[model samples]
Target chain A: MVTTAAQKPILLSGNEAVALGALAAGVRFYAGYPITPSTEIAEVLAVELPKIGGKFIQMEDEIASMGAVIGASLAGSKSLTATSGPGFSLMQEHIGYAAMAEVPCVIVDVMRGGPSTGLPTKTSQADIMQAKYGSHGDYPSFALMPNSVLECYTLTIKAFNFSEKYRVPVILLSDEVIGHMRERVVLPDPATLEIINRKAPTEPREWYRHYPDKTTGIAPMASFGEGYRYHVTGLTHEEHGFDATSQEVAKLLEKFKNKEIRNTKELTMCESFCMEDAEICIFAAGSVARSARQAVRILREKGVKAGLLRPQLVWPFPKMPVEEVYDQVRFILVPEMNVGQLRKEVERLRTNMRVKVKGLNVLNSVMITAEQVVERVLQIDFRSGSESEGGTSNG
Target chain B: MADATNQTAEPVDRHSWLRGNKKFPHMWCPGCGLGTLLNTVIRVFVAKGYDKNETVVISGIGCTGRIPVYVDCNTLHTAHGRALTFATGVKLAKPNLKVIVFMGDGDAVAIGGNHFIHAARRNIDITAVVVNNSTYGMTGGQHSPTTPLGMKAPTAVTGNIDPPFDICNLAVAAGATFVARSTIFHYQQTFRLLSEALEHKGFSVLEVVSHCHTSFGRINKLGSHLDMLKQQRDHAVVFTPELDVEKARAEGKDLVIGLLKKDATRPEYCDQYEKLVIQPSQAKQNRGGV
Candidate 1:
């Protein structure tokens, strides 16, 4: 069915935008367990999916939900699942399985405060590392962080496109603030947006190899009921999807998939604000990015040259964008909800550049306000040579 | 492959239903009941004439989970204890596709208990083949949820104190449309139960009581697989009221076999969704109601 086109500037929360974005991306199936801050996405899809012949199931648990999403996608349905901290941890097992089997599906983790249900109704970006290293083994991960209601729609669409085209799992990292905040934005007509799907093999059934080696490093996928009768297992497998213990089979699943996904530079998107002639760069994402935007304006009005570099995708790390910030600014301050999570990624890319990176981290179950970021940036004495090498401050 | 007895004109083309001839000399140990169960499973698929393309077999992690690898059909080998959830998605996506799940006793009643009961409660159209070997054989003879009381294993070295589960009774209590139990020694009964499960419209579970002699038996001093099979064959009896009930109990056995429940009138999951959710939405759409 064609998409239900929209024209008006509708008021929608970030979670609601995600539900609509999934519909526009042609997601026909969603299996998820409702968790705090993310349940609205499930609620919206539960109401909307049936109107367009789509399927929505509230599974027994997060693990079952992730498993069901993979199964639906294998049966040729575009699928998605949404969850939060503890639930996201449960989904890591199947997330790794989807990576090895090369099943195209999306998982949205609306970040909440945690070390196991630390704060249910509060916001945090603590899942930054979990998005990449949560699951065992080496696999490719593409994570997109949306800072607003509008971006929640756009990036969820991008999430599906990347998951399908790369034949790998794509994670949409939505924090509690982005998931709950309501904003008025004109929704894009679904036809005007880009929607990419996995390429289907044109060859006959007998000649089909589920994971054929290609120069582009991605093989066409065939659905389960399409008479292909292919095998899919979590175990390491050769091209035809049968299990094998050889090193060649082990490298086949990880090597090419990582190369193809990481090489796609377009997947790593970053936004720059007020950096025409700036000295201090503010780095943040998701809810903190919105605060950083406001902090940039306050800093400029106060006669301090401050700019912002917000990365949309955090997995491939977007080193080029951060390097651009390093070249233009000698001091960088990262304000985030979690104490030194995304800040660690920024410091890791410290490179050989003689720049001072500091983090204004808050983990009090509250957001890092714009005033706190401005206060921390003003206090960073970049002239002190001893503190020039990467330092941190808890707000 | 074991030929089905007590039947007329059963399909004999077993090779056609199996994956490839190279996959033969399967990885199962000699005298393993899983192999016997697989042999009978293929015969049932052949006899029932299930399409290799449309029939999707899903399994969770364990020895029983590996059965999908040998079936020449659309197959999925999922994480431990998650096959029913996966099979639920497959059946919901394409209701016409035949979805079957193979799970071991531990994979079914232990780690997968929540999913197992929920799948039956939902009355989803998927047949679950739970091979109850009373132990986690793949993990080297750890006692499972179905391991008999006082049975010995590596995990239960001093003899298991935990009471065992009845797989069919669990399914029946969980609202499954069809439920049955039969030992591998009762080959004909097991064959019939599996065939019935495949054809059932809603959630159907056929608990095939198997013996892991290498694991569950050897540690308990139960001799070889043949001895275990002999014990099962001697104890198991068809559920019939006409038999001598007092005598059977005195001999240490009773009605422990045959179909426990079959209710065809219960509404199926996918059918209910189509009727209750889709039809009204489509009606609203046709009438120009947003």
Candidate 2:
């Protein structure tokens, strides 16, 4: 049912909203293998993309699906692939390859409960750390988390934009609950959205170096068959894409890892609700952010002045905003679907603040509900709190 | 075979396109069969009049994988066992371009065996020249899938127990439109087979038994590059018009040089996909009167 013009609008599942968002974003190629919760995305793209002159390939496996998307992207097509926990695990090596090669593409991980195949259709935020550290070696990656279908639609578009802007693989870390559940979302016209295209080289073919110009952090990428001869590899390479084994070259490549991300500070978007006046703040992302939001309102009505800090851009950690909220709030509460994944980051930065930081960790099939978060926040006794003292609850 | 032999046999000029870099003078070791096989591929490409820019060469990880880097073309040196997969993408993405895969026996037969079978089964418009050097020469003389039984390699000191795969037979069984086998010592014969494979409309595999002067030579006591080449020449038996698969297998000899099978019944991968994907889009465009 549609709400008033200002209130929550139409109802849609997170996966359906993402499909619509990709369609609106002019996604022409979708190559994915069927996996739990994320399979709806491939099914939808298969039916919808062909109507728009786009192509969808259900590849033999996750490895080939990832390869197909990379190939499609090289051929001047905006492509994406979606998978769950195990499939995402299979794609880790190539994800590193994409990062090293600076290929612009989007990967959607509808995270299921797992170290292996914990829960195929069940939801968990356990993959938060995996998404960051799963791929071997040191390289920067962008991850976006959406707590609702509306954000799922908007953030997926943002994912594509960030992929193009930074010229690196961007991940939309949506969980099974957010991916499968229905909610209200609005589909805006394509013209209203700000689309980012990759920066093409202005220099002539002979003068162009593929990985040159470390000043901007991102080198201009030339598509194949464009008369500009360049090399790309999974190895640590020089400006010409040849294998470079020197320490100085390694340092130069490492500089790119930080520069590409540091330039896109505006892309780091977050929302703070009643955090300015609250003594207790709840930090969350993805579906748990919804529970945190509701918990804040419930605590506020009870005169506790509790607030919620939702990170839209999970990577780069949103450190500045968290540090800003750290000054105003005496107690920080983190509720996650997994066991204390993102809580470690919050605790590391909570030094000398004398704040009672607590984590509401859960790994079973159940999600962290608003009532559970509220109960955890209320149980934190400010009178007995100390620098060394902390609380944890397996909800 | 009749039509291929009847075609003009102009001696291919190899010097004009050769890049003169003495430091990397023939990156392949002297008398390595890959050098001779590579010379044949280059000559065939020239004879077919393929522009260097329009040709795409893909290779997997091995000594032979370096073939694409030396060639002046749109080249991709992909990860192990993924050259055919990458070539599939390259050809499907850009249907007009001519895609070729230069892979070694271990690269194509061991790790990339699945991709090889699938590419042939689909009959994609691509040519794969597999340089079968018997052993995994680049990584030391290890026993590969194509290494003959009783062959003493570093990994198989007791002699390899695994039976060798007849790659041409496998390719023909997997539905390749053109399947052929040749040796590096037979330079003209190798060139002729490669030229025909390139001209074939569907997936074509040309298995060239090349000499590995470093690993195989050291193990088998074949001292020099010339000695190794002589061994390949001695072991290889040319298939004739009178021989069939049963007759060839019954002879207890590995039929080395000649086309094994040529069939054009099945449709190519791209042509089938285009009919299913691109044709409808074209129809809609026509209806819109664009």
Candidate 3:
């Protein structure tokens, strides 16, 4: 959508909306490479960032882009980069570095079909597991899924907030459909949005620890010129950020997971539609959630009790919402663009909940449609006799 | 200056650039030239009166890459061959800060060659101190882009027939405003070149031809560390305008140990970005336009 000077609600693609979201969130530096689907974000940013007194750089490759974003973030700038699956795979090492060094940066992965660049311009939620555990070590990551153009704007802002508040790299897991689909979006005024800036070190230099092992698992960050001179590395280190190759140092990683990841409450975001007094729920994320919402509406019209639960925060996977809605629904149908990546997680986390977790997967970069979702939900034969028992994941 | 060859005395604390006693008994091997190079870097910092708060030291993976960790400045030890990329980010984001990258031959020219060339071409205001050890020392002395012809390495079990890269020539060709080559054997000259490179307001590269006695030396039969230093002193000739590259190589003096390029008039990247991005926006705002 071509944004005119008029300030009314304008049509915008998810990529354009995301770039606007970064501007609204006070991002001052963006480094990225051109990749399909996600490339629009970089293009929009390249034009818009300069207008807002921000910087944009097209790096040589995705790995360098990620590294540059992390570096800019460490220099006290809210920085970001956007890429697709192949580029996202190249960024995994630096993603780990950002996690280890506790840099506040945002990575927008407009996921496309992949294992090795499978689909250049098609949608897929195939990067779900890669986003969680692609890096070598165990470190916390915050990945958000936006199901609509408006959510792409709002959740990108939220991703920046999560990055600043947690001092960890946040991944905005978008898909090709949402990235390219044009929709009319009413953007909130930048002043009205809640922007969270990273906390600076209040303590003096002598007492400051870059990674303080506290209950909250968050420490104030100081940029390069802020006089908080410190060492940052990818190696497992102590609280002060020095290489400590000891068993004790490795044990400290538990606190990083518990405090920043598990203990945090507000970081997890999920939305449910038509879930009240429903017998079955379709679980989805990213672009597929849009289909699930329409599928639920279709099922509701037919007097078949079905609902949709969409997890906006895919990582630190909001299991509580799923658990809360677990007993209320008899079956949870997980539909994905991949071979049931999220379905496995749903099964793993829904251990004690006596719900039948099933998967409706469409590979080859094909999106799962609303009709297919409705058919899958309607195919629940009553005579099967508790086939939903034994929480084995079905693809 | 203090005896450049004296490896016994700890100079980091003496110069007040060392972090703390905890980082002492440094990670460099015995008779390693990284310590001397680090001492020269400290001298440059002190000599130039650079505030510690305004300096950011970045390095990539290798023995030379570990130099930033021991420094008391805001140091970042990045992934292999990506230090320049990170330093570019730092300089572009915070134009006031002095960004310096420490990289090894493999980190600078082999895997990271693309980034190095682009950084030079972009002419970002960052000083790159490339330690040309002619081999990938940290990864067991694999052949690097700077390895001389017929040199033996782990990856090249037979003699390496690949020609070596002249780092200064590459940087100059890629539009670096300041380029210099010096060796650890010529400590005073290396220190002088570092000082000049740090003062230059554009992309500058100070290539330090140092000896990697552990891997490169062991494989190539380049004698002890002292013998390598003697060889450097014997072969390295001061770079001059009239010197012919062919003649220098013919005399077993391929190392041109002096300033090879300096173009102060060329525009720097960060300044250009500010002029191109911020100035126009500010001008519009000043004229009462949104």
Candidate 4:
């Protein structure tokens, strides 16, 4: 069944596509817990990894799964783990540890409606803030939101690439709608796919700094048991990876933040539709972006000059592209499956702009429909038009 | 050697496995038993002729967790109670390398107990040394899960109503192939037990009954570190499966300090995984290469 002849376009859920993408990315180890919306990623990896000489273990719990992935990564394996809200919450401590220690790994959080397991079988974008600040401390993180099943595959591979290239944990944030939704994906030929391996140390073992404070801020990594007997700690450490508490050390450790922020242009990925000549634009991410796209098409047909701005790179939230369209648009409609998570970010970008940013939020894990978005857009337009006419008539 | 220019071939002295001057003036307080436990493992490493390059020492958060830092080996100081989980990956990924984990009582028995039991049940080939001081030493004298009943701590000022865990017995029950207990006062037995645990092929647990003079002792009025060591000496009794539990109870010597369980029948975890999953996949790939 795995023969090249059988490698035609096949229907796959977003979760299954993610597993295949991880395989294509040379993910040699996977440790995950069975949780709603994200369990299929684990189930698929468990069967697929063993066939491809990769190791997959359904850990005792989410916390252990995160721990195992970090360990595997440290031992020179492209490792991953997938979970949802509650499990992602349990993994926060280890996620912070991975960031501090600079272990490269990927985490897939298929977003579920939650303050605490709110909607397991349902979807929500409420975890957007949690993905950025859930782990305690000020460390850099990369989170990519996939709008389609195909994006799920490509973005998951991109997540691995970014994690290894930057030495940080990359979160592939999907929702139940995208995670469980099935679509046809044309499998890429393995030979044509570009695979990126981590940069190895060029210096002598005595001089190698696992956490080097250099120009690029990325230290060359040496896996365990290759004769580089070094110390790795979650504690704030100096360049050589020993515990330090001085103010200078704290200042030096700021490289983690600088590395990602400086490279934000490359890391920030987004897609804009018909933004060249638009009066009103819809801002959305994750699976809801698909609906926004459809709504934009309908609004354009109705001659309302509507467009859609979908953020593929959700974190370090792509401000430049959105700012580019700020003057071009009269209003921005932010639609989400939750009560205004990403909407707040969009609203933050609205500083002193006459462009009114309105949130079209849906709770209880119900997806925002295209018709609902069209209704909101038409209502806002009507209200804006009436206000303008009323002011002129009163004068 | 071409790719590993940073690693200089330094001489390893039999008397010292310490990393370098960077880790000098160790963090362990005066007369802390953690040093003795760490020294015993280093001696076994040298005695067993294990390559420093092939040994990875992992630890969790605690005073005991700091043991890996002072050693001149590949070390990973991970989050609290997650050393075994990390070691499981290290051992499975590179089965030839020796993975040893050092954790405290609270780390192993309380927060990390689930990982410990699962690692043991799977019988993964790794040596886990649990340093039992009966209190959270690093965070101050708080009562841990292994704190003895009626003992005083910061959290249990009056007395701890909960009974302490018999760590060796717990490990034995958890399916650890090799389980043993020894006190800091019993130096020879500590060395022997640690040596044996390292030599065991499957999941081996050696619980070292150590004292935290800073926290547990100061609160309980257990005198200086030496006096606590004497207390460990006085309370110790050799353990044997044939020993009558009632007699030991009546003798007021419930602390059994010796090898508790040793069974080598069960297949090791990583070995089975490699055989079942890894080898077949490799053979298929190789056969398809034709």
Candidate 5:
């Protein structure tokens, strides 16, 4: 939001900012089951949503919450749900359903440690891979990762905007450290914020099709009782109310799902920190990015020429900024709370094996500190080129 | 087969709400009770004059769940057992819509029991049509939560040791504003109960006791689909508030059919939401609360 000057800076946690951001982004309905590190989001919305005449429902479980959110969105409400790793797993089926059905909604996964209930109330950026590939089958996703409280508020609004505009489910990956960490954020004027809403069909009711015969396959969705009388199912079907479609329709769908490349240039919400004339770079996102930035500054002061490539929008991978960093840098240091989940992704972009890529993975239910990253970078003997960290994902 | 696209309000006939022969031959086995359940539900919808546009028929994954696919209205076929949650969202978001959820016994109780009970507990303005077939027919006949004790299915080749849940009793106990039960054989009674259930304001659950005659019957040697229909007729007795169900056990009748309970005074979920949440905020905004 553009303002002559920002309003008074109010101290709010990352979770609080997310809750406020959802409201500002025109999210009118919320369905969720409370889970650790993400419960505050539900708690905040439960109190605030009712004040604005918005709907909030605590569903029986994570599965029900996801289902309800989709249902509410179909009936023409901007809906959202928040949960942690365990809950996110439960939501995978419905997430796939929303994508296949082309329903617009937002899901916030406040990252907590887990393969299965691994660590609650602990900070870990472990769910980066899960957010992209947890749900079976491909669906176009626009995900945002907020490293700070301010980014939490702004990126959340952007997440909703992208979700509505593209008619896809957007994910917000906020880790426990950032979710619980309080920061002074200057809240923007509501009027100044740019809010995007899902497109409505202008065609007559008699000619209405839930999925139109158009390229990109994005159709203007009608609310359930608004008299358009459309059909939605998880089944693969054609434009009309006909049952299932053949192989021809499946080929037409190739352009529709996960095809968010050239169109979403504005969605590359990554930042380059002190990368000018740097030989070493760090790739990180979410809470880990904060430490990476600090480590970059520390390395630069010591004349190491280190920089950081932080992906605020983790998916679609922010390729250009990464390529710019990768082309110039001699070594890429990826430090994260998880055991190198994102490091595997960075390795894929390595066109040159000469560029030493390594991850300082810490999965001890604690935040990766700036000092630890600085130590990891300083310990690297550049001339000898003796690498200790594994380079390949399979390795 | 003629294209069923944009057929504007044809004369109220059996084909009006149905997709007609377009989606046929229908997927169900010839003797499956799903056909009876579907026809009766459509009949009730027609008699009650439910505008197709203003209605949403949702279903979970089952032969019964296929009801939404065949109905010419706003239909949503969602995940198995989660239809109630989805229906809840649709109804709560827009109170004007009549949201009906159709689920099989396994879908409604086994995988979806938590949602089922809670939806009733909240007394939300949605009609739950639970077709209790006592088996998971879609996946071959397997013993479901409603499968009677000592009944045989593929999963329970030996007699089923697990006790079955009474769908109507579960709904009533879970605070459903209207609860009723009927078999596919009792066409008129099923239609009447379904019609009343749809008319009720709060959560209304109508349990249609159906049969997976091909699977359950063949395994248990219970004869054909006709024999299963005869069994539903013989086993069922009309439920009355004054009738002693314990006394009926002596008569060898276990199934209780008809309206078990209807409570009109309890506040419907949607109306309460409108009054408590919507009205207060509107008043505040009118008073320049913003």
Candidate 6:
């Protein structure tokens, strides 16, 4: 994993890489409560941010930290907060508010095992479902998971960009493995980064609608006092940001749900390896993506034409791209840290295609190894007979 | 009373900047003092020429929480008891914006009590107008932190054994830069006190004794909104600069109407944050641009 010195490489932990990413992306305000596997984010920012003329506040609790970050963002500062599972649960209400209010901010959930403080230092991807449905009510949220320390830096920057561009809270979903693991990350100069600020109103203040037309999907966000005095609430609201309690408002609310993720299929990113002519395609993300990649490589060595579809953007659930791959493959094998959470989504979308979706779920503390994934891929009953049976049919 | 007649009658010639949907008059019960407090806030906003665009009115869930929906400012109707938390975000995101929070007794002193105190302790630049009706008015008048002792409410059928909190005293103790208490009946005093609170640079709390005709009124046999207003008027006492803590305490359970404390020396949370985060050149950089 070594690179030339000209690449501006630095050895850093996942938390450090995240901090560096935020700093490089022009995040000037950070408010977070310290929690295991995520405390280093706040600790590092507390010292590094201040030196770089950024404000860092260690709030009394996770709720206040979320509140502070939201406040800082509304005040026209690029702001962020970091927390783990339990803290993420506490932040759900506000997170929903961020979605409804269209506030641009990043939330880094350095996940540890938990329904309630299960393993504070240990890793778990149990929050995958929570990230999608944790907040009550119907709304769309963006979540990105990074497997390595380098991806931690890259994805955090992406999180900020997505948040600002979409004007919604984007979750940088990292786990204990990446948050604690140290590796080399080549830091990009600030000038090389693409930072997206929220779109501002082109119309007059009086005419501006906080939630504009569904075409752009993103409305112009006028900061307070910029003359576009509009309303923002967690309730079902009209385009003007006023509380709208009518059938029309309900329709608009549905649009709010769809426009963010629906037609914009390109925003969904995933990595595919050896899928050009494969019979079995394994789907996975985050740490499991690493194992799936390795499994695909091992299967290729064993003369099995298996491929991997590793989603970088875990939600808006890559359904279309996944279905496209499903059309070409005889079987889809999905592996996850949790027990078949993503498998459910895949099965649902692949229904019309009649693709056989099998899941390799590892609920225990151990990571899903490449060997296990390869074994599972080989066992899949694709039209091409099982790899162990030495069948030559590519169907 | 003196200022009330003059200020209301000779209304400031400001634009009717309030964009609140009139169809939804308010969620507060008839005769609720929150209406009076809201009117006073509107008046202050008008008088000060505060641009509706720059003013953000945030409210938590409760009867009082509905106040922001009726205002024409950039409003945020946040989750229950989390207005301070959300308002903290709005204020920090736009430090130049004038942010205010409206909360009920329960929203401020019960579920949101921690945030209330911490926001004050940090001296965040936001005005919190706590409409203290002494019970959880929205949830059918459950006993709250401010529900008077021996008050018969649904949650306290045998009468509330717990002592009530003097919210103004609590705010003063928690380091609020400005603290005041006023009742709806004292229109002039309430308006003036709220105006001062809004104008204050640091965290300010104006705990207004509001009437909840539906719940608190029914149980206490407070007759009606008129009767409750009169009761508050009768029970309130004016505090002077010469009044000591002992003297104020001796007035006991009565609404002490006056600015209890003012500490302009404390640095506002936003000012401190700006100093820490914004570089000299960066501060001068155009907002919403790279």
DockQ scores for all predicted structures = 0.80, 0.35, 0.67, 0.61, 0.61, 0.46
Q: Which consecutive 10 residues in model 6 chain A have the weakest lDDT in total?
A: A386-395
Question: What alpha-carbon RMSD in Å does predicted model 4 have with respect to the real structure?
Answer: 4.8
Point out where model 1 deviates above 4 Å: A1-6, A256-262, A381-395, B1-12, B241-249, B288-290
Q: Residue B117, candidate 5: how far off, in angstroms?
A: 0.7
On lDDT, who's better, 4 or 6? 4
For candidate 5, what's the RMSD?
Answer: 4.0
lDDT tens per residue, model 1, A179-203: 9999998888876899999899999
Candidate that would win on TM-score = 1
Prediction 1 TM-score vs. true = 0.95
| Model 4 C-alpha lDDT versus the unseen true structure | 0.85
Clashing pairs in 5: none
Ranking by DockQ: 1, 3, 5, 4, 6, 2
* Displacement of the residue A275 alpha carbon in candidate 6, Å: 1.4
Residue-level lDDT tens digits of model 4 in A1-395: 22143458888899988988898888989998899989999987776777776788878999999998998898899999999999999998888888888898999999998889688998889888888999988988789999888888888888998889888898999998999999987777767666677899988888878888774667689999888888999999987788876964765567877767787678679898988788898999988888899999999899989989999999878988777777788888888876677877887776546877777877756778899888888988989734421110100
How accurate locally is residue B84 in candidate 5, as Cα lDDT from 0 to 100?
Answer: 93
Q: For model 3, how does the per-residue alpha-carbon lDDT over A238-304 read when each residue is reduced to its tens digit?
A: 8777877676476557756864565547866888888888889889998999889999989989998
DockQ of 1: 0.80
Q: Interface RMSD, all models, one decimal each? A: 0.8, 2.5, 1.4, 1.5, 1.8, 3.7
For model 5, how does the per-residue alpha-carbon lDDT over B1-290 read when each residue is reduced to its tens digit?
Answer: 11222222234565878776567668899999988788777776766767888889999998888888888889999988889989988888877888899999999988999999999999998999899888888888889998889988878878899998988888888999999989999988987788788889999999888888788777888889999999999988999887789888678788889998999999998888778867886677567574
Off by over 4 Å in 5: A1-6, A213-217, A241-243, A256-258, A262-264, A381-384, A391-395, B1-13, B278-290
Better by lDDT, candidate 4 or 1: 1
* Top-DockQ candidate index: 1
Per-residue lDDT of model 6, residues B86-143, tens digit only: 7776676567788889998889988888999988898999999898888888778888
Candidate 1 per-residue lDDT, tens place, B1-290, comes to 23334343334466777776546768887999988898888878776767789999999999999998898899999999999988988888888899999999999999999999999999999999999888999999998999888888888889899999888889999999999889889887888999998888999999888888898888988879999898888888776657675788688774378887899999999999899987887788788776
Query: Ten residues in a row with the worst lDDT in model 1 chain A?
Result: A381-390
Q: Which rank order by lDDT, best down to worst? A: 1, 3, 4, 5, 6, 2
